[model samples]
Target: MFRSLLIANRGEIACRIIRTARQLGIRTIAVYSDADANARFVRLADEAWRLGPAPARDSYLRAELILDIARQSGAEAIHPGYGFLSENAEFAQACADAGVVFVGPPPSAIAAMGSKSAAKQLMERAQVPLVPGYHGDEQDADFLHRQADQIDYPVLIKASAGGGGKGMRIVERSADFPDALASCRREASASFGDDRVLIERYLQKPRHIEIQVFADSQGHTVYLFERDCSVQRRHQKVLEEAPAPGMSAERRRDMGEAACAAARAVGYVGAGTVEFIAEPDGRFYFMEMNTRLQVEHPVTEMITGQDLVAWQLRVAAGEPLPLSQEALGIHGHAIEARIYAEDPDRDFLPATGQLVYLRPPAESDSVRVDTGVQQGDAITPYYDPMIAKLIVWGQDRAQALARLDSALADYRVLGVTTNIAFLRRLAAHPSFAQADLDTGLIARHHAELLPPASAQPALPALLAAACWQLTGEARHTAHPGWRLNAEWQRTLHLGYHGHPLAVRVTHHADGRWTLTLPDNSQHVLSAERHASQLTVHLAGQRLHADCLQHNDALHIYLPEGLSVFTLPNPYAAEADAQHGDTHLKAPMPGRVVALLAPLGEPVEKGAPLMILEAMKMEHTLVAPGPGHVAAFYFAVGEQVSEGSDLLDFVLP
Candidate 1:
């Protein structure tokens, strides 16, 4: 085995690779950008080097610099984790030229499979079943439109050079094809520097299943079963599991063999994923092959009792396959949930900020957390905002999902918004529990999945906020004479959804209280504190809630969901309301990618006016109502501050 291995990546995957390398008694080297100097992955490696600035193009994506660092550090191999330079075939070839083993497929395989159109053609020549589509090189707009019309409506426009749902759009109507194509092309160019796209027949209720294939330098390759990645948001998978819920033994073998054949067709080596789109009838079509490890690889690891990272190390060291295809069998069911720094309520837009307080569930045999961040880590807008990958194993899918839901509820993050609550609801969703999964699951049940905001906070959460306020008062004042043997009533001030929430609370000599809601509802409260938790007896029912007070925000976690209440700031609230009611300010921090509003042009309600690119996704800003473009404050490509006005318009 190579004595020193360099991880050419950052974040959770980098840390994940280091863990396996250390286990095999190999020294690990980590490379980081300026933003990740103090990141968890950096601290975990035996040696670390700074690549460049925070932006990926200046740092992690600098393939030449990474190769030089590996040579200087005497690293025998470089492991490119999923994103960044992982699938860059040119980098792989460069590593080979430097005499450093690239712990992935040979450059020839990567080059053959890197482009979607090329890969589809190669798969066709190799006799692998493929989805019918137009994989041509003609990039003329008219030509593409004709292809779309021929394929008919409800076709998928996919970027020829990228995956991960980026640069992908689904056109449902012939009239919308042109606009969708424009948007898809822009996104593809920005994401992969390639605007070339192909048209394909869209799948209705498609279940995404992928085979995990591994190959060694000894010309041996095997498939370690499959993972169902059907649940998605914005085309990115949200939930994944191994040993697909309804996969038959015969079908599994067929798909497995097809995946291996696809890999061998390109002379593949190391770890790669062959993804497929399957219908309910068990018929599947080839989608694309990821030339590196996948974000949801932990599910495969749990079911097969294999350390895929370790396998990569062994394979890169010219070792034979660790376990043959016959020896690998599904041991148990496993599921993985990707925890991201995003707001599911806000179109699942990525969020950026300090991780004020993060408490992931402790790891064990059945529960695991793969994270590149720790408490106080800042999630910047320069890269992907995935916080962690939460994986759990059980005897079956039901048990695995149940454990996943429980673990999600236990996880906590503050300072910035996250999708933990959304994840919890998704896992416990009735359809999901029954394995009624599809790629459109999130969109189909959007109403039930993302319910409207409640007008008032729950009684338990209100009590917790009251306790937080009283505790702070108690800690700050030296004398307790104000409430010492007497009852006192005061307004509990808190803010939720940018609105002030005031409730009347009366504290008595006994460990009991009377609470009145804003709407005049009353409740008798008896809360017993146990360290950081509380057992509240409210409305004659005993309920346990996890509560924490941090940085003026009182986070009360209930069995159903998490509610955060901040000390009421009337000034800030008024400002926010006025900003929304008067002019449209930037919802989230991002750069103005384009301006759609023409000067002095009258616009109807919901007219697209501008596009803000933030957190690596484009968000179109629309006119709230009929209005005339009165003024422009920011130009295209200008960085706009959150809550700042982008333009001012006169309502007609």
Candidate 2:
């Protein structure tokens, strides 16, 4: 359609747009911040432009800079890949004024539907079913409390300009409304620049179902079914699937019709999603309309076998709708897991580091991985820490879920912690397998779904580490008789993912080894090394091991996990505390949005200190103890590469 286009985003979505654009012989230009200068998306683009510093405001969110990049790169259009300026009406209007196509809806539609409060009002006038709530602009505390009382208890206070769970709070009792509203407004103001909010009845056990609608300039709109994104943490979706499990044909038709009506009423064009919150009783209501392509569009593409990005470009080029609602059909089930660089064990905190080793699950006909990082790439604190999106498809829901589980298990990432284990556990859980889940399911069964500490499987790894270390030491025995000494024994200290394991390997004269543990369990083992297979015999059981040596340290890969150990060389010096360089840090790598206190300020225990935004969600980092701010390493707009110190405090 167009000669070239600039992608106004980064990460997997930008890479995804590039893939489809290439398929259509369209040259793609990529814009990057300092953090993403070396990102895979930039390398994959036909041309690239440096936006600004790492902070989003100076780069991704700068509409004028993006427009200038498009002009300099000779890009005829701009694709605001979800988030950032994707939903900004002013950005859309700016593109229109610059005579460049904004591959999204009209600015008028974005302005009308961008605000949740305004969208709800317009939906009501368009005869669309809406959740009963207060949408008035009265910000008076008492007036809002009165409105909440009228709507009844268990109401949701949502930011009028928010999406992705920002500035949203749920109040269970009338007494909690005041505090919740205050907190919600503060966060709303900080995140969206809009403190205006609305109140709605909080639906319990709600399943978030949203209909995918695509339209063109011809005023023809078609529905692409729906995606169920109920599996979430803090209102951010973890997993998404299309053709929701147990969805009846009748309900699908009804929701699709309603979504199309909403789009047509606003004269919506291009790819957009109409989100609805469906109650347990099967009743659904219009929540809001996203004015651009969604992050989870791959799940929809997998089932429909249509390239949504290509459609976006074609629509922007003034093409008419290619398929009508009646012709569009979903052929299979698709599930997508948002693989984030986060530590699931530690409250799902976001993590940051150089990706020393990054191995996504092996690709196949039924699976797709949308990623934007490469090995040795650094995940900075200036952006979302989502490493990639894993999409799996199958003939049905059960098969898709199983494939997704296996895919997550095969994923491997090092240098920084990830939620792969957490995702695998959730996908394999019985409740998830049966699709009996909701937004709160993860929190409800958090203990059950958590990676079991007991199931970490370290014995095999310990044995490998011990065997490798002992064999290396025995190879250099000073005395010839020392090699044959039955009493030759040494303690091996091995390091696992991070924790240390003590292993005692005693090599006997008979060319066998006896391993003893702190738990008093003893195993006799024999080792046989081959080019490909390393076998270890323990007692009467024979097991395969993958063992190697790197930098004089023994490395062993077991079925469960990997282990590393140093040889018991008497001359080898003890390891220094320099290894502390890599320690526990903030969750999903993102810029510090706010510092709760001034530098050198004293704070009470549990007081909020800093707020970090990642994966489109904000995480408030609180003081661990009563302390005085020792240092503030981040400014309001400075991009501290993830793990870069946000601040430090001295304990009082």
Candidate 3:
């Protein structure tokens, strides 16, 4: 084992690597940017060093700077944790030149699989099954269009050097191909600095399954079963599981062998994954290869009882394989759900804010949480918006599903929007519970998975918020509801989801209270508060909840879901109603990428006006109605803050 190790990444994966290194008695060194100066991972490491500014290009991707840090810290090895510089072949080769061990595949292997087009050709020679498409180097738009026309409609345009669902598009009709191709190329150039792309037949209703393969310097390779990553949104995985729901023994062996063969073909070493697109009839085709640890590797670890990071370290130390192919076996089923700070109802737009309050489910032998953020950390626009990964294990798939649903219900977050409620609904959906999954599962069941936000707060939420406020006031005042001759009455005005709500509370002499809504409906209720936890008795039922207050906003956490309410301001509401439609503001902090509509020209409703790039994704601003853009406040290639006015629109 190495005496000292340096982690070349940040966030959860960096924290994850530190834990394993500590167990192995290795001194772990962490590198961070200005944005992560006080991050959890920095505090967990034995020593930490600052790289540069918050942007990745200024810090994490600075190969020479990282190598210099490794030399100064006396690190014997460097672990590239999954993103940023994980798959950069030049960085790997630079570490070698600096005389530091790189805990990943050799640079030759990474270079061979760097480009999607070239990798497909290599797999062809290796006799691996491949999807039919154009993998040539023809970059002409007309040439690609002709190729797509020959392959038929409904083809996939994927960036030659892309991963993580970026720089990819699906054209469903002949008329949409040109626009889709242009958008795909733009994203590719922005993300990878390479605009080359290839087109392939888009497989409808296909399940995504990938095999985890490991190799050592002694030419020994083995497979660690497979994970089904079929439930996805926007071509990115949302939920994953091990020992695919209905995989047969014969098919599993065949796919495992094929994955190992692919690894051996490239002289691969350390941890890697070979993805495949499988049909319902048991036929599968090669998709692509990831030359580093996967984000969803926890599910595989739970089923196989192995620490993959430890394996990567041992392999990099020139050790033999831990176990032969015949020695490994699946123990139980495990499922993992990625928790992100985003709004699912608004097309999964990334959100940014301080994590005012955070609570996760209890961890046990069966439940686990992998995260690098604490309660006070902020989810900024400089990087990915992932909060954590929740993993659960059970004796079978049914038990795993039950645990997943229960765990998702117990999660609580505030100050920014989250998709916890949506995940709970997705886990309990009838189709999902029945194991009927595909890449388009979320799109097919969109109505059920993502219901609109409630127009008004639920009665329990309102009552809880009101009681919490009253009890807090009582702590400061001696007799808040004491009256000489009559019961004391108070009214609370709150806003939820843009709707105003007024609740009237009357405290009676018998130590009970009657609460009335705007519609005159009344309910008898009483509550006892201890810190932030509230125990209430309402209408012959007892309920337990958590209420957090920040400034004038109240967050209610219940068994059903989360509700956010703010103190109503009538003047601000009226002003917003008058100007909100005419003033176009940036939904989140990002850089202006393009201007689609011409200024002072009339455009129809739903016309795309501008494109903003944030959190590694593109968001298109559209016309709210038939109008013209009178002026633009920001130019292309300029950064804009959240809620900043970007343009002014005039009604036709």
Candidate 4:
């Protein structure tokens, strides 16, 4: 095993690699940008070095700087963890040229699989089944459109050099093919610096399953079963599981062998994943091969009882395969949910803010959380907004589903929106629990998975907040002299989701208190507070909640979900309400990539106006109604902060 290793990445994957390296007695070195100077991964490494500014192009993507750091730190090997430079063939070759081992597939293997077009060609020669589509070099718009028409409508436009759902689009009809193709190409160029694309016949009701393959320098390769990544949004996975819910032994063996064949064709060494799109009848087609460790590898680990990172290290050191394919067996079912700092209600737009309060479910033999962030850390816009990956294991798929739902409820996050509630709903959805999953499962059951947002807070949450406030006040202030037979009264004003509410609390001379809701409903309750936990008794029923107070905002955690209430600031509320639709503001801090509508041109409602790129995704701003953009506040390619006005609009 190598004595010293440097991780050429950041975030949870970096932290994850460091944990395994330390277990094998390898001194781990971490590289960070300015934004991650105080990040959790940096604090966990044996030695740390700075790369550059927060932007990836200046920091994590700088292969020269990283190679210098590896040489200066005396690292024997560099582990590129799944993103940034992980799949960059040049970077891998550069590491080899610098006399440092690259703990991934050989540069040749990476180059072969780097482009979808080339990979499909290679897979075709290797006799691997492929999805029928166009994977050629012709880039003319008209030519691509003709190809799509021939393949029928509903073709998938994918960037030949992209992964993680960026630079991907699904066109449902020939009428929309031109615009979709143009938008897809632009996004592909911006994301991967490659405008070349491939067209695939979009499979309806397809389940995404990927086989995890490992290879050693001695030419021994084996498959580690498979993971079902069917639940997705924006073409990115949200939930993944191992030993796919309904996979038969015969099918598993066939897919595993196919994955291994692809690995052997490229002389693949170290860890890699071959993704496939499987039909309902068990027919699967090769999608693409990821040439590095995957983000959801923990699910495979939980079921197989193997440390994949350690495997990577040993293989890079020229060791033989740890175990043969016959010896590997799936032990139990495991499921992983990716908790991201995003709003499910808003098309899953990424969110950026400080983690004022974060409490994950306690980890044990059955439940695990892999994260590179902690309380008080910031989820910046410079990197992926993933908070953590929560993995749970059980004896069967049913038990795993139950445990997943429970763990999601126990999670608590504030200061920024999260997808915790949405995850819980997804796990509990009838279609998911029954194992009837597909790429369009979320779209099929959108109403149940994503319900309409409530305009008012729940009664129980409001009561809990009021009781928590009263208990806090009682601890700090001296009690007012009570009248012989009169009750003391106090009114509190709170806001929930922009709606102002006022609750009246009447404290009786006795022990009980009365709380009147905005609807004039009354509840007589007794409450007790212990730190962040609050228990309330009302009308012979007992309710418990967790309250986290940050500044004037109170985060109330209930069994159903989380509710955030704040003490209303009259001045700020008025200002926010008055800022109407006269200007279009950026929802998040990002660079303006395109201006869709010309200035002073009247556009219909919902017409695309501008595109702002943030967190590796593009969000298009639209006209609220029939209006013309009067002026552009920020030009294309300029960065704008959250809530900054991007343009001024005048209603026609």
Lowest summed lDDT across 10 adjacent residues in model 4 is found at 471-480
Model 1 lDDT per residue over 347-447, tens place: 89888889988999889999999999999999998888999999999998888888898899889888788999998888888989999989999999999
Which portions of model 2 miss their true places by more than 4 Å?
174-179, 455-482, 485-487, 494-500, 508-512, 526-617, 621-652
Clashes of each: 0, 7, 0, 0
- Point out the worst 10-residue segment of candidate 3 by lDDT: 473-482
Model 4: per-residue Cα lDDT over 1-652, one tens digit each? 8999999999999999999998999999999999999999999999999999999989999999999999999999999999799998999999999999999999999999999999999999988999999998898999999999999978999999999999999999999998888888878886777878999999989999999999998989999999999999989999999989899999999999999999999999999999999999889999999999999999999999999999999999998989999889999899999999998888888999999888999999999999999999999999999999999999999999989988999998877899999999999988999999899999888888888757656564456546555555322234445677888876676777777667777888777888888878788888877778888888898888887777777777888887777676658857766756667788899998888898887899999999999987889988889989889988889999998978888886
CA lDDT of every candidate:
0.87, 0.81, 0.89, 0.90
The 10-residue segment with the lowest total lDDT in model 1 = 472-481
Q: Which order, best to worst by lDDT?
A: 4, 3, 1, 2
- Give the C-alpha lDDT of model 4: 0.90
Against the true structure, what is each candidate's TM-score? Answer: 0.95, 0.86, 0.97, 0.96
Scored by lDDT, model 3 comes in at 0.89
Candidate 3 positional error at 344, Å = 0.9
Candidate 3 backbone clash number: 0
Q: Report per-prediction Cα RMSD to one decimal.
A: 2.4, 4.8, 2.1, 2.3
Minimum summed lDDT over a 10-residue window in model 2 is located at 575-584
